[model samples]
Target: MNTTEIFLIAILVIFSAPYLVWRLGRTDYWAPLVVVQILCGILLGPGVLGAFAPAVYDHVFAPPVIAALNGIAWWAVMLFVWVAGIELDLHQAWANRRETGITAGLALGIPLTFGALAAAFLLRWPGWSGPNARDWQAVLGIGMACAVTALPILILLMEKLAILREPLGQRILRYASADDIAIWGVLALILLDWDRIGRQLGFLIAFGVAAVLVRMMMRRLGKADRWYVGIIWLALCGFGADWSGLHYMVGAFLSGAILDAEWFELEAMDAFRSVILLVAMPVFFLSTGLKTSWEGGGPAVFAAAALLLLASVGGKLAGVHLAGRILKWPRRETHVIGWLLQTKALIMIIFANILLDKGIITSATFTALLLMAVASTMLTTPIVAPMLRRLGGA
Candidate 1:
């Protein structure tokens, strides 16, 4: 078949396989369609499907076909991250400064510490750290991955639980918003290239000037015009960051972060996000899976994933429990919040992707982190639903 035909078949498989499993298997309560899609990607990757059927894999994912798919994936993830950035509710976080600070601080800090320790241990073993990574870079990158919360996925899960507009949901958003900013800031720090320091500084200076103009123009324009301009801004920022040795994803996040969410119509934002997920993000997931490897072997990868999952979940809960004690939260609130905050899907995946792109972590480490994120997200709804029910009963 031609490249176009092969690419179409790949796309068909990407969307259809996940939807079938998600719908027919009835995993919605525990594993959402997004989670299932990620799993399907892993299964279809070179490590799994390609290992068994190399001939088929080569034909289906030919170089030209893969390149075509990657173009779609890059744009898809950029837009997704940009939307997540735009949706951050920093104003709400500021309004509840004390509580948001305490919660977001402990929640991010504790996991990061534990994850760093875990990464320290992983460093003892070969094949976990990438060729280009310094010891500190590997540790910090992995640690930050554990600390990431998928703000976009968290919003989706909250809507599923019917608490998206509730007081508690709004509170959660504030905490996550604060952490989101920190996550991207730390990412920029990790990605900083000494050799390209001048370029990096230039990018920052340019961004600052451009942001002022962008914000002003956004305020004056119609919503429709703003949407068009936002994409142009997203592309420009992404290019600038990539040119500066920081990843384009960082640029994409900054592109949206400077804009006010209130500038766009809420309904339109929701529809845009949903449409992107439905149409574009599956390609990103497929691209992610294609990068997976088992160089350290399946058992080692799974073990690493389990260990990281323990660190991520344990650290999050421990930090939140400490916050509950300090802030004197209501009964069961801490448990519910901990599980909800522990949710890691899109954001963590994106974080790990950047780490891999920068050669800070190996493919084995990336595979493990991917599995940990999938498992972490799958556990959220099941655990939180029961906790919420018990809290309601009390």
Candidate 2:
């Protein structure tokens, strides 16, 4: 089959699947839309359908499509992070720093410690013949996964449930916003080589200094024009970071955070979010879904996935609950916080891909971690919604 045939077939399947789902009275299903496209790609790739129809999957979902998808994915990620930064109510966060601190401490510290210990113990056990740093990898992976809170999803859930104004909701919002800053910063430091630590810190300090300067400039430019200045600042930040060997997304995030502190207007963010939601983000999610794999492994692979998922979810609940207890939070609030912090997405996949790309982890481990990522996201979404609702109602 030629490229045209492959593309034509892929396009047919993509369009057809949604119509089929919609016809089945499932027009509201985002998961099936993403999942089906991914499964189709797998089937068409060298994996399954490609085994028989080589020209179709390979020539079709080829480098061009893959690259295009990746570009879309990054754009979506930027917009998502942009929304995350904008949604952060800095004034409220400042007022609630103590709660934010306690929540973040419980949410991050316990899971990281437990995960690291588990990794160390498991690496020395039988049948795991990977690297000598198997323990460290496992520990770091768990810590990173656990420390992640789905800021985008959490905010959407909070809004959907009309709990955004509640005290519990407010704290979760504030802490999650603040927590991501700390967690990602820590993950970047831990995951990157030690030699780069000075460079990374220097970049951060420089970014901070630049942000202060930008804020002053924006203030002088008048409040109404700050959003435009903010956008330019964000772009510069991302470009600078990308050029400096750090992730552009982190730069975008910090840029957004700085702007959020300065502008702090939900309406301004709403203006930006319209384009991000309708256009940019779906591409990112679709590409992320496409990169995911769930094939060729047997029971052990699936078992490892299950184990990681359990650890990810269970550890978060326990850790966040502990945070609540330590902070003298009510039981209801504690459970809600536990549920809120359990979802993982982009960073997990990105990190796993990095490790796989760097030859740090085996393909099997990468597959299992991908499975872990999907499972973690699925489990947290529904669970967090109800938990938030319960806390709000209480």
**What RMSD, rounded to one decimal, does every model reach?**
0.7, 4.3
Could you tell me how far off, in angstroms, the CA of residue 63 lies in candidate 2 after the best superposition? 1.3
lDDT of 1 by residue, 78-194 (tens): 999999999999988998999999999999999999899999999999999998899999999999899888999999999999888999999999999999999999999888899
Task: Identify the candidate with maximal TM-score.
Answer: 1
The models' CA-based lDDT, in order, is 0.94, 0.61
TM-score of each: 0.99, 0.78
- What TM-score does candidate 1 reach? 0.99
Lowest summed lDDT window (length 10), candidate 1: 385-394
lDDT of 2 by residue, 1-394 (tens): 6655654565556446544654574522223233333333334445345556777656656877667666766766666676576666767767877777777766776666655554455455443223533456556764565456767666655565566677667878777777777765764554454556666667778898998898778767766677677767777877766555566776777787776444546666656665665455445444444544434344766776676676677777888787777788889777766876775554455555545444445555665666666566655546655666676587
In every candidate, how many clashes are there?
A: 0, 0
